[model samples]
Target chain A: MSLHHQIRQYLLDQAQMHGWLAHAKIPSERELQTKFHASRITIRDGLTKLESQGFIYRVNRKGWFISPPRLLWDPCHRVNFYQQARDQGMQPETEVVSVNPLYDAPLIRHQFGMDYGNNLELLRLRRLDGRPVMVERIYLRQTDFPGLAQQPLDGSITELFANKYQVQINHESSHILVCGTQSEEAALLGIPEGTACLHIERKRYDANDRLVDYNLEYWRQDALELKVSSRK
Target chain B: MSLHHQIRQYLLDQAQMHGWLAHAKIPSERELQTKFHASRITIRDGLTKLESQGFIYRVNRKGWFISPPRLLWDPCHRVNFYQQARDQGMQPETEVVSVNPLYDAPLIRHQFGMDYGNNLELLRLRRLDGRPVMVERIYLRQTDFPGLAQQPLDGSITELFANKYQVQINHESSHILVCGTQSEEAALLGIPEGTACLHIERKRYDANDRLVDYNLEYWRQDALELKVSSRK
Candidate 1:
C-alpha cells in the first residue's frame, strides 16, 4: 500500500475506535504531508476518497473532521427509518414538537380524498438518536385517531397506529428526492440555508389499503443514506 | 377549499401536465398573486408550502420552478436502472463508452480473492434516455472471459455474464450513498459540478455464491428516487 493510503487508513481506524466521529478532528493536509513525507496531492487524494465514501466531512476552509457513518437502509424492503436504525443497533427516539388540527385545503383534500372542511391532525417532531438527524411532520385522519393528539406524544407512530387506533399499517409508498434546505427546514435540521437534504414524502396505507397518513421526513445529507437492491 | 389552495392545485396540475419541473420557469410571484386574486402573503404561503414539500425548487435571485419527480426503486429485489425506468413508462438506454483491462488493486484483489498482476477487464458506460443520466462501470475477472474487452458490448451485463461466462447471477449485495459530482463524473453525466447523485456499489454473486462482478453506478439525482416500506 502507498504511504498516503497507509496514513489515511491509520486515521480512519483511530477515528472509528475513538467513537468520536461526530466531532473528531484529523491532522491537516500539511501535517499529514510532513509526517508521511508525501505530496499534498497524495494526501488530498486520500482524504477525498474517504470523504466520498462517507467517512468524513469538511467545514468551510477548515480541515477535515470525522463524520458519523450514515445509516444504511434497504430500499427494497418495507422498513421505516426508526426501525432500520434500531435494526442496525442504533438507538431511535422521537421528540414530539407540536400537534394541531388542520382543515383540508383543496390540494391536500384531493390527495387524501377528504371532503372540504374535513379536519385532520398534524403531528410534528424531530427523530434522532442521541442527536437530531431528521424532522417529521405527519398528518392523519382525525376520525381514525379520535383525539390522538391529546394522548402521550412520545413513542413510535407505528405503534400508535396499531395499539391505540387499532389500525394496521400494512404498506406504504415513499417518494424521495433532493433539494436545498429551506429556512424552516434548515432551522429544524440545524444546517445552513441551501445545504442539500434528502426529502421523503410518504403516504402510508392501512391494511384495508386506505391512505391513513401523509408524512414528510427531511434527512441530513451528511448523516443518512438509503440503499436498495433489485433482482437481476 | 381556500382560494389559496385552489390556486395551488391549479399550479400543480399545470406542472404535472407540462412536466415543468426544475429548470423550467413558472409564472412570477406577482403574476400568480394577480391571477389568483389572492393576497401576496397567501401566494407566498402556498409557494412556501410547495417548496417545503419538495414539489418546487427556488433560487435566490430566480423564482421557483416545479420540482422534478424522483425514480422510486426497491433495493431488496434485484432490479436495474433500465428496468426501473421501464416500469415508470419512460424510455431508457445504455451507451458503452469504453472497455479495458487493468490491474486489480489490493482492495479489489482481496475483495475478489484475485492474484497480483491479474488483469481485470472493466466496461464503462453512461446510461441515458435522450441524454446521459447515469454512469456505470463494471469490472469482471479477466480469466472468465478472455476476449470480453473486444466483444460487442451491448445489452444487459447479466446476459453477457450468462452467455459468455456461463455464470448465473443468482444473488448480490449493494451499498448506496450520496455523492457530489466530480469533473470526470460531470463530463460523463453532462451535469455541472456540485450536482447531487446517488452512488451504488454492488457486487454480484453467482449461484454458487462466488463473486463475479463489481459495479459502481452514479445516478443523476433528478432522474431517480428510492422508496422503502416499513412493516409495523
Candidate 2:
C-alpha cells in the first residue's frame, strides 16, 4: 500500500475507535503530518480519499469532521422529511422562508394541470443536526387547500396536508439530477456557489389522481447519497 | 437576466438549432468573449453555468462541447446497456477489458450466497457515440456459467447469457451514489481525477431467484444525469 493509503487507514481506524459522531472534528493536518512522518501533501491526499468515500468532510477554515450518515429517502413511502430524519436519529428542523400566492409559474402551472388560477409558493430551508441539508421550493394549487396560510408552516408539509386538510397522497414520482448550487441556495445551505447538489423534482398525487403538489429540492451532496429503488 | 445568463441562453439556443452532437466543441473562450462583448471571466461564468446544468462538458485541454443526453436506466428493466442505448438513438459500444477467475472475494461471495467456490471477475468499458461513458467491474459465480471464457464477450453479455449459456436474468437491484474519480478511473473515462461521478452497484438474479451476478459501475458525471423511477 502507498503512504497515502496508510494514512487514510490510520485515520479511519482511529475514527472507528473514537466512536466518531457527525461533525466531530478530526486531528489537524499538522498533527497527522507529524504523527505519520509524512508531508502535508500526503496527509491531504489521504484526507481527500476519505472525503471522496463519504467517510469525512472538510469545512473551510474550520477543519475536517465526521460526516453524518446519509438519510434514506423513499419517494414512494408516506414518511416526510422530518419523520425520516427523526427515524434516522437526526434532529430535523424546518424553517419556512416564505409562502406567498403566485399567479404565474409556467412549469408549476403545467404540472398542476391548471389553466388559470393562483398557486401558493413555498421556500423552505431544512436542517439536520443543526446543519443545513436541503432547501425546497414547493408549489401547490391555492384553491385545493383553502386557508393554508393559517396553518403553522414551519413543519412537515406532508403531515400538514394529511391531518389538517385530510388530503392523502397516494402516488409520487421523483426526477433526480446533479445540479450546481446557485447563489441564493448557497447562502441558505451554507455551501459555496456551484457546489454539486442532489436535485430532486418530486410530485405528489391525491387518491383521486389529482396533482396535490410539486417541489424542487436541492440536498447537500457532501454527506448524503440517496439510494433510490422502485419498490420495497 | 444577467449578462452571463444571456450568454448561456445564447449558446443553448444555438446548440438546439444546430443539433449539437456529443463532444461538439463550442466557441473558444476568446471567441465567446468577443461575441458577447464581455470580459473573459464573464464568458467563463456563463460556460460554467452551462457545464453545471449538464448542457455541456469540458475536456482538459480541449474546449467545451455539448454533452450527450443522460440515459434513463431502470434497475427493474430487463434491458441491457447495449440494447438500451441502441433504443435511445445512441451507437453503443462495449469493450471487454479483462476476465479473471478469483478464489477470494468477500463481498461477491456474500452476494452469491456461497460459502465455497471461485468467482469470475470482468472489467468492461462501455461507450456511447465513441465517448467513454461508464466502466464496470463485474463478478459472477464461476460454476453458474460453465465455459464462460470461451463465449464472445465484446457485445452484450445479456445476449450471450440467454443464447449460449441458456441463462436468463429476471431481476436486478441497484444502489446509486455520487463518488469522486480516482486516478485509474480518470484515465479510463478521460477526465481529471477527483471529478464527481455517479456510481452504481447492481445485482442480478435469475428466474430461479438466485443471485447470479454483481457489478460495480462508475459513470462519468459530465453529461449524464440519470432519472431513476421506481415503477412502470
Candidate 3:
C-alpha cells in the first residue's frame, strides 16, 4: 500500500480504538503530517478519501470531525420533530426560513384539493444537535387554520395545529425518493451540489379526512435512519 | 449557459414534451450530434451529465435509455417480490446467487436468538422488468427450516417457507439508511462505485412472533419510491 493509504488506515484504526464520538474534531492536518512524516498534500488526500467514505466530514473554516451517527426516524408515529429528537437524546432546533402566500402552485393545490392562491407556504430549517439535517417546505390551506401565518412559526407545527385549531392530523401519506440534491438544498445543508438526498413528500389530513397540509422535506442522507414496522 | 448545458436543457425539454416513456431509448450519440449540430465531445459530455443526474442510464452493448419511474413500495403489505412487481405492472425475477450454512455470524445469531453456527445464508439478485434493481442477503436459522438449501430457491422464499414449513411471516421491522454503495453492491446493481443506494435491513418474525429471518437489501436509488401511511 502507498504511504498515504497506510496513514489513512492508521487514522481509521485510531478512530475505532479511541471511540471517537460523532462530531468530535480529529487531529489537525499539521499534526497528522507531523506524525506520519508526510507532506500536507498526502495527508489531505487521505482525509479526503475518508470523507468521501462517510467516515468524516469537513466544515468550512473548521477542522475535520467524525460524522455523527444517523438519527432514527419512525414515520409511523405522529411525534413532532422536537419530541423525536429529544427521545433520541439529541438536541433539536427549528428556524422559520420564510412564510408566504403561495400562488399557482399546481401540485400543492392538487394535493390539498384547493384552488390556486388558497395555500400558505412555509419554509423551515431543522437541525439536530446543531447540525443542519433537513429543509422542509409546507403548504397549508389558508382557511384551514386562521391567523396561522401570524403565529410563532418555530417549534412543532403539528402541535400548533392540534392545540390552537383543534385540528388533529389523523393520517399522513408519505412518498420517499432518492435524488440528487438541488443547488438550493445543497446550500441549505452546506453540502456540495449533486450530493444524494432523501426527498419525502407528505400529505396530511385532519380528523374530518380533509387535507390540511402538503409537506416536502429534503434530508441529508447521512443524518437519518428511518425505521418502520409492519404487522398483519 | 455553456454549449453542453444548453444541449442538456434542450434534450431535457424533449424528454418532458415528447412524453418519452421510462426505459425508452433516447437518440444515439451520433444522432444527437447530427441533430444538435454539436461536436461529439459536447454531446458525450451532455449525455454523461444527464446519466449522473439519473435522467438516463447506459446499458453495455445497448444504447442510453431513460430511467424507469420509481417503483412504489408499501412495506405494510406482506406481498412477495413477484406479487409486488406484478401489482405495479412490472415483471420481477430473482436469481439465487448462492446459499450456504453460516458459522460464527454473531449478529445473525443474536437477532435470531440462536447460538453460533446455527444460521443459513442466502444471497439473491432481484430484477425488475429485466433490469437489476436490488441485491438481498438473507440469514435465517437453520433449525427453523431444514432442507431449505436443497430447494429450488428461485421464486419467493417466503412462499417456500409458507408452503413447506408452514411458517407465516407476521411482522417485519425495517431500518432504512442512505449511503454510498459498496463495491460489491455497485457491481451487482451495475452502477458506478459510490453511487447512493438505499440500504434496508429487515428482521422478520413468524406467526408466533419468533424471529425467522434477517434480510439486508440494497436498492438502486433511482428505481424505488417507498411509501408509508401513518394513522393516529
User: For each candidate, what is chain B's TM-score?
Assistant: 0.67, 0.80, 0.82
Model 1 lDDT, residue B55, Cα: 57
Clashes of 2: 1
How close is every model to the real structure, measured as TM-score? 0.67, 0.81, 0.85
Top of the candidates by TM-score:
3
Q: Pick the winner on TM-score between candidates 1 and 2.
A: 2
Cα lDDT tens digits, model 1, A41-88, are 778756654554456655546667777667776544756667778887
DockQ of 1: 0.26
How many clashes does the backbone of model 1 have?
16
Q: Please report the interface RMSD of model 1 to 1 decimal.
A: 5.9
When summed lDDT is taken over every stretch of 10 residues in candidate 3 chain B, the lowest stretch is B45-54
Residue A159 C-alpha lDDT in model 2 = 82
Q: Against the hidden true structure, what lDDT does model 3 obtain?
A: 0.79
Q: CA lDDT of each candidate?
A: 0.67, 0.76, 0.79
lDDT by residue (B70-97, candidate 1, tens digit) is: 5667655556667877787666777777
User: Which residue runs does candidate 1 get wrong by more than 4 Å?
Assistant: A1-20, A25-66, A75-91, A114-123, A127-130, A229-232, B1-91, B113-123, B127-130, B163-166, B190-195, B227-232
Pairs with backbone N, CA or C atoms under 3 Å apart (clashes), candidate 3 = none
Error of 2 at A214 (Å): 1.2
Docking class of 2: acceptable
lDDT at B227, model 2: 57
Error of 3 at A177 (Å): 1.4
